[model samples]
Target: MRRTDPEGHGPVRFGPPLPADGLPVLPELSAVLAAAAPLGGSEPVGGGPALLEAACAYWARRGLSAGPERVVAAPGAPSLLLALTAALGGDVLVPRPCAAWWAPYARLLGRPVFHVGTPAECGGVPDPYALLETVRRVRDEGGDPRLLVLSVADDPTATVAPPEAVHEAVEAAVGEGLHVVSDETWRDTVHAPHDTVLIGPAEMLPERVTVVTDLAGALLPPGWPAAVARFPEGEIADDLHARVLDVLTALGARVAAPVAAAAGYALTEPEPVTTRVAATVRLHARVAAAAHAAVVPSGALARPPRAGRHLYVDLGPLRTALGAHGVGDAQDLEEFLTARLGLPAPGGHRFGDDLGALRVRLSTGSLLAGTDTELEECLSSPSPVELPYTQRALITVKSVFDDLRDDAQRWEPPR
Candidate 1:
């Protein structure tokens, strides 16, 4: 029952997990690099013409009508978000327990942030009723809450916002005249392709929404930073697009020529790229489900993952037991898990959740370990978790939970 030392010799360093590598590299990358066509001049601030066309085509595939003129590309989603916030200057409203980076970016821009709690079914968008309430409250306090940021298919919680929730939140935000920024980076990574019911705010209220997507999430290789934004059509969209470009140009932020070419090709949704994305979706879903199952027996509550590479775990049910071991808050729980399991599970507080909540975001990407060939083989197998590399990772995760639960049952705090 003694606490394990995270830095001790026996601890397992689960990760700091990188994004999975089972997806195939785009074949167009070689040709694009060889041609070296885009390297000569600076791309337009919004994006180069070829990249914009590909982005338009990408959105078209998703059932949203877009033109090349409406698309803007940036080095990555975060940079795009920074530019967007600066361009649409105002206080930001985000769901409590949102992607870890959202509030931080708002703070960096010196904008006040209001965190509204999410609905029970999802983690990205705020609860519909709560959204209006938070906005009113912030405005009453003399704050200009003009921007609402969200992810339709969320990251830390790994759940997609249901269609009804999306509609209600959008209706509420639009009513308040708050411009919406929907980060749809993980929309393509849904585990069950048929189960995806994402109705982006852009589709629901196009004129009021700006859609941002990170290609690195599903298509491009890790470290290849590229993302695109689809602004709503018309004069307002044009103005925002211009402002975003001006900011990007000032920052000297442009996606590299070779990377832009690779991005353009992937955005075309080539068959190979789509197939690889499907494989990743399947692999991550299975691994995350296994991780979820492993922790549940220890009294951890987790939503079954629907997309992306994370699982949000709440140890509140085990609070009494955890508290006996001096793990009373989110920070304590995070440190305890890291020490015992060597897992880099960040506490919910980092994502704007209450510090006292016993929640942590668990990244499941480490489960896809081994060389690319081995990972690709695992992805192809009917039972991926049974493969040696994956199985070992799952087993380690389960064993940690088992040990924690066993220790919890045996330990008693001194009166």
Candidate 2:
């Protein structure tokens, strides 16, 4: 289960990308890029006027009013976040099992990162009580806790935080004089938009929260490397936006010109982009549910998949069986499951969770997509979960967990 790339070829990536989603670029996106490629020129740092305006429209739809001057765009969310972290300095606080890539940016700035435990209901926002206590403890120990990063629609664990939970967490953070960064990357990918109550911190505390969305989570492919951030508008935002722009300028983190054009178009939410995103959400929703059904039936614990393309399964209930198979911790479980299931399953350790916990994030993207042709078929199929190729993939997942269930029954000692 060892994965290695040759040295001196390229730098290794450190982040939460659960392998690439192998789906082809939407034909509409490709057309936009092709047309925009010819008018290529460097995009201004932050973003061009058009891109920023489109970003405003996007945010406006989400019940957050933002002006073009208050938005920023970068090649990726990590870059925008890094710039944000640099611009607003101090120790960073993140949920215990935050996005795999979150805490690293704070460390890049020599800022201490403290992991706060999440509430039982969700994995994105920290438990409100724990957040208050952690902030107090950090300050008492001379750690300047100034930033809190959370997600309403989270990765690894695909559950969306309830609006009440988000409100309490935001209140706890801002009450302590800390700013919030709400990563809404997966907001548009909600499996059941009507059933979920997602409230970004920005909606509650406009002046203190910054919203970041990576288009890869829905509108664009990952390789395109486009994301946008919205800062709250006020007199203070002028300085904050300029500081972030300065950081982007120094880091050369501008979105490529063609990417800017495509992003601007995507942000406008045209029929094709909207339709593709809707279908993709539906596709992932079906596969994620099937994956969850597979794991939970084997006595594994998992939050229901409400958003995004993955499920976070805690196999602690099957630890005896897994340990019998020499899978004692998250790392070993990651390797074992990936090797056995033939998918890219990443351990919870990658997301700052305890290494001893037998937890992993299973991506539906690779599970349902064995070939490009099959991907297209599933994407268009009326009942994708029942489609031949998709059903085969689901069977493969179910078989692995069924084996684990059998092993658990045989391996665990009777009371």
Candidate 3:
């Protein structure tokens, strides 16, 4: 089949392909396709302000008093975040090992991103004490230090801040006059009771915080591209909304009629889809746990994933062993595994992590193996034995773990 690279080396397959149901063509969306379609020249050039109001009302019912004027809708959260970067008029502070998107967003906004230290428990929100120091240093360097972007229930790390940590972060942001943007995209995917705090930005810093959540993370497909942001009541709310509209209008980032309609339907539906999605989340949790367990003896430590789809493993403990085995860095290890181990993982470097840091984000979504029919069957089953692809994935991953474990050089005693 000539699948190998041009060099004729062994073939490497890093990860699984995106799923069908995970895309936007689900039954719920299909139902709303035409009804939610946006009329041409829809008076509001950017977004339907009325639709923004409805979303705000929806979020308010969920414990956030979102003013419609402060609410904005866009094609996705990343676009809105870039607008925030422009509006805040300063450098953005993001924790290391954040989503791969942040760097591009920051670059697009022409803002320098300060990679801050993450809390021990989470990946996006900075450590409180470290934040205090970093803010001062940033100010000293003449940066505006006006914005903080936190990906709560973070992506790559799969850790959510405990309520107490959230409280601390809010306090720090407020103290610094830093406008906070809490990216709660993965809020709905939380698995454990302690895995999430239902509080929104309005609950934390009613005046200073802006909440932007891309329903794409949960309800919609990745390419579906529709998101809502809540701006708290203030004079700047109207300005921010207008600015958001401006960006959308210029970028032509309006949510597609069919996708938005489908999203609205999913939001209100009292159907089995939510249950189906939750089951998928549970599957991810299981795969993450299994992967963590398998790699534990190999010095790959994962911070018990609480929410979201990926498990972040710190391979630092085995760095020396891998180094001896001629693995150059985390990227090198990712390359080696993709080639030798047939596991595709996004390198830690993609997430603004240290180049040499032995961290890798492994998404278990590959385990959702099967056709749409098979997936539906699996979703319906009490405990579906994973299909062939998933079995291959587990075996391949476990073999990597087994290899590392058997190699005496890889083990490191916990301090």
| TM-score list, all predictions | 0.91, 0.94, 0.87
RMSD of each: 5.6, 4.2, 6.2
Candidate 2: residue pairs that collide: none
lDDT leaderboard ranking: 2, 1, 3
What tens digits encode model 3's per-residue C-alpha lDDT throughout 7-55? 2112333322222233224665666666656543332444565566667
Backbone clash pairs for candidate 3 read 14-343, 14-344, 15-344
Candidate with best TM-score: 2
Candidate 2, which segments miss by more than 4 Å at Cα?
Answer: 1-14, 18-21, 370-373
Task: List where candidate 3 sits over 4 angstroms from the true fold.
Answer: 1-25, 34-46, 194-198, 385-388, 408-415
Runs with alpha carbons beyond 4 Å of true place in candidate 1: 1-42, 411-415
Worst 10 residues of 1 by lDDT: 1-10
Best by lDDT: 2
Whose TM-score is higher: candidate 1's or candidate 3's?
1
TM-score of 1: 0.91
**What is the lDDT, from 0 to 100, of the residue 389 in candidate 2?**
65
What lDDT would candidate 1 get against the real structure? 0.80
